[model samples]
Target: MNRCLISAAMAVFFFFLAWAVSLRQALLFLVGIGLGGVLAGARFGFTTGWRLLIENRDASGVMAQLFLLGLAAAVCMPLLAAFPGELGAALGPPSYSLLIGAFVFGLAMQVADGCGSGTLYKAGLGIPLNMGILPIFALGSFLGSAQLEQWLQLGSIAPVGLVARFGLLEAFGITLLGLIALGWAALRWSDRIAPWFNKKLFIGAMLLAVLAALNLIIAGQPWGIVYGFGLWGAKAATALGVFDPTANAFWSEPVNVRTLSQSVFLDVTSITNIGILAGALWIAAKRKVGAAEPRSLTGTQWVVGIAAGFLLGYSSRLAFGCNIGAMVSGISTGSLHGWIWVPMAFMGSLIGVRVRRRFNF
Candidate 1:
């Protein structure tokens, strides 16, 4: 089918998904975000470079991320103004600890070859090992959050928005426009950088930002990812007698809190993550690349990657998102943790890459 037809179909599916899922439920939201990601890949003809993170091919992800991040920030400003006490309690003061945590998460992404959300998309497309890793990630996140609560406690930072003094549209518009301009100017200055400046990324980012903002306006919350997966995972584990009650308190009941947990999981965007997976699969099938092929990796690589995923997942829970949810999504919302996590995660990623190389991963 043509892009127009595909886009229209996806739009309808995602809208329905948003309405169908409940607050404090994120499976649907993750689906929606994943759909957004697939839409991004589709717009680019499922290029391997883009799909698998080749040189500058993945710049689309960066652009989309910047736009989304900015929009998130704009929305957050006014949110805090309207609910300072509440926001303060959940976010805490952004600190060095968050930075360290973020670095560790980033490192894990490198080792895993995908961030939390990225892994989900690949997993949904029948990447068997990703299937295994996803659950391990959940367990890790649960354990990490439970164990590192105290050390990471000092980094709670509340969100600040340019919107409280302004308005959502106004703030979002300014931020979005600024980013667009920056992207444009960056591309304009260097022809070599031209290849990295993807129009698809820009379009997808803006479109998703608008969609996300609208969802928030109507649904009474911004977009989020981890809670839905965490809750679902926790519930499943609890059912299986594998999860510990004391350690699993937050994981088992992420929705009960009056924080972003409820909003992230329960919001309309939950379906976005799911849709991303489906959309990626749809593109894969159309391109005749739909077969689920096993990725060949050393046994040692798998063990290390999966083990690292546990750390990554747990850190994400403690810090509020994996790469996409925390670093990308969290920072975009101006949560402060986003910036802190980026560098720290990069450090961990450097180590992770070396580890992968040592294991021939």
Candidate 2:
């Protein structure tokens, strides 16, 4: 079948999948698909307009990411303002823990080669090791979450809302225009800067805007991906009875426990992760990205990567977002955590690079 037909068929299939699932979950799943698809496209060297962000090689991915985040934040502002108490409540009050957790999680992303969403997408695309890493990372999240449940109990500073300040359309429209212009400028600047930037800047920025908006429309919540790791992790642990029931003493309420648990089965992110892998595999098969195969890595390397993934996943949950969740979605909402996580993760990536080199597996 033609690529366009295949793409259209995939869209239709997802539409039906969305229809069969809750709208919220459907939207999140689609968001995951979009994210994975874009990354995969970039990997393939297909600089399709507004879809190129393969390696984040240039400022292309960065600009697009900023736009996407800006759009979401703009939309969320009004929603929060209208329901001040509710908005203030879901995001919770910010705390110092977010800072600490975000930094560590950021580092984890570097080690893992991708954040939660990116990891899933890469695995989907037939990255031999990432496929193995997915469940192991999930396992790490579970173990780490069990260990860090206490810190999560603490809350953070409340986020400011737009609903309190402006109407939905007014907020979204203003934000959209500003974000688009900013993205456009960033793209133009990148094009003049270097080779990498020129090819991907505008497309990356536009996709960022599109993904963020699509996430808002579908998820009813802003885009996020960290919780999926923790949820899956927690569930896996719970199934194994690895956690002590009293370990949850840090929780302000039982609802947190339930939410954490529900993430395993109910989180749209998790479902999307599964779908992204499936979609990527489908595409990879046709494109000859290479068939999935188990690679021969040493036992020690596996343990280190898995351990690093666990640290990242657990830390991401504590911070309340992963790369996608915090960096993408949180930033889109203009939350402090997003900003905090990005730099921290970059530093962590440094550690990841070192570890990869040291192990040399």
Candidate 3:
């Protein structure tokens, strides 16, 4: 009963907020709420899912992600081509910043135990540590964004879109084949069938792909996570008079300037972010939510987790995304940067696991 009331209140609050902004904003918020529910109820998580494969060589979670990526790509790339500027892909410059940023993000997530979307939902579920991690993550995001322009100047290339370069047909085929190969690699490595597939989880991933596609269709761009967090932190800092957006290169960009001045709810990523957290909370209050088992950690572990959360935000800005935004949406949009992000992040994951073990974490 209490859960229902809380959910109702959140819904009302977001509705009014979104409505006050625009109907489109409201719709995006609704999609975000749906995303949160899907994430919580099905327990769809990119961070722990990747960790499972990394630590145990369990490929089930990775396989589902691949499927989701492939399906999203099939639907999204063509739409981007047809609509051109109206429908944007999650493209990023191929730069040293992306390489280093993604690698560090991977390591941080392993220690922090959540990626962008994962952290949002977990925090929404009221996990005490995750809740604590949220603000620190926001702070790191603000700092990272503040310096991002300087990093890009070091060495960067224009953003590439596979559909634009290869055409929709070719891009789709290549993307599908790549996903199939990735899925097969995951399958072959597992050496068993029993754990290879779960009908419910597989279906859940497929549905997730659909929702992701819907996000692109409605918002005219792919779903993003870290950008919203960064925006929030920037806004808070500005409000506190600790920072001046007018001087920050990244914030001073024409598009960003407008977004910062406007209500946060008008921001596509922010609206969805709010929905995911609220939806996750509603689900946790109603039924068993999807999450790994909890365990007690040492004081060292807690400190590491908190620090890692900060890194997760900072590194994600440098890297262009977390697991969902980079590995998932990045690949789905057929950006070469997405491909680059994965292998580097995976390498970080390997190192992260060993470091974690030393702490017995």
Listed per model in order, the count of residue pairs whose N, CA or C atoms clash below 3 Å is 46, 24, 0
Q: Which stretches of candidate 1 lie over 4 Å from their true place?
A: 1-64, 71-93, 153-194, 242-272, 289-295
Better of 2 and 3 by lDDT: 3
lDDT of 1 by residue, 1-361 (tens): 3546766766665465446654323344444644545444534221122222323324454455565557555655556456644442123236545666666776666667666656666665556566678788767765655555475556554554434435556655665665677456434433443456466666665666565544444445445555555555555565688766555444434443333234333434344555565666555445444654666877777798788767667767665666655554554444445545555665576576666567765
Give the local distance difference test score of model 3.
Answer: 0.84
Candidate 2 TM-score versus the reference? 0.71
The predictions' CA RMSDs to the true structure, in order, are 6.4, 6.1, 2.2
Return model 1's CA RMSD, one decimal.
Answer: 6.4
TM-score against truth, every candidate: 0.68, 0.71, 0.94
Better of 1 and 3 by lDDT: 3
Residue 36, candidate 2: C-alpha displacement in angstroms:
2.2
The total of clashing pairs for model 2 equals 24
What is the lDDT, from 0 to 100, of the residue 321 in candidate 2? 69
Candidate 2 lDDT over 1-361, as tens digits, reads: 2456656766775676667656666556566666666656654221121122222334455554554466556555655556544443124225566767766765555555666766776777667567667877777665555655456556455654333345566655555665677566546645445444434544644564577556555555665555566566666666777765445553224855666645343665566665566556555556644555556778787777677667766676666667666655655554555556655655555455556667774
Model 2, residue 311: distance off in Å is: 1.5
| lDDT tens readout by residue for model 3, 231-296 | 999999999999999999999999999999998878899988988888888887874456555677
